[model samples]
Target: MNYSPELVQFLGSLVAILAVAGLAWWMKLGGAPELSNEKEAQAAASEAMDGFESVETAVDANGRGAILRDRSGCLLLLKQHGNKFAGRLLTHSATGRIDKDKLVVDSGERRFGVVALAIDHAQSWADRINEVRSASDA
Candidate 1:
């Protein structure tokens, strides 16, 4: 069997191209679901605190605070101060727990999977007030 140099070079180049393309696809170089997920989170945040206005946005050495507020009182403060998630329901100090693959925030009085996001960083008891205001407003 006689083999040509040009044919061997073409095969080698084809293999290299395929390997590079596979790696690019695996790494998601062209922006995939990861980017969409971030946009989705932002949308969720907005939906969670619908009536609130962004009063202040701060990100210092300590952490980040995207403070939002409503007409009557403060709403949920999305804080990134050394926490697991980007933002959590910031009404109480108690940690979030899981119940049958669901998240529950135990604030002593109530324990629920979904709590309406209320005012952010307006007052000390802003979260409590927000819940009340939201109920009344609705």
Candidate 2:
């Protein structure tokens, strides 16, 4: 069977597109997984900073982010990035505040930007994180 140049080119493009789509699906890079519970958040925080034992954690209501405190009073902020969660240990250069019922945390990394988590008693968490900032400043 004979085919025109245009038809062959179109078929090749379609095949290439399909291959890329299939590869993405196989690699599981399509969506970000939610941080559903404190265990998951704690794990992510530990991965971000080794020896980070979560004494307390507040999971975001929308499952987009989390904030955790270690035994030494250190706070670890977890934010969703791609399919996994990226974390920053809140010490120096970190700030937190409550906007309405949500706790907004800034890691001060600029690129990492800000993360807002809706948790119970957001202000308390915010104050705890600010304490981390204060202690580092002194």
Worst lDDT 10-window in candidate 1: 56-65
TM-score versus the correct structure, for each prediction: 0.26, 0.76
* TM-score result, candidate 2: 0.76
- For model 2, the local distance difference test gives 0.87
The prediction achieving the highest lDDT against the true structure is 2
Task: Give the distance in Å from residue 20's predicted Cα in candidate 1 to where it truly belongs.
Answer: 18
- List, residue by residue over 27-55, the lDDT tens digit for candidate 1: 87764221123333444346556543434
Q: Which runs in model 2 stand beyond 4 Å of their true positions?
A: 1-28
lDDT value, residue 70 of candidate 2: 80
The residue-level lDDT of candidate 1 at 45 comes to 47
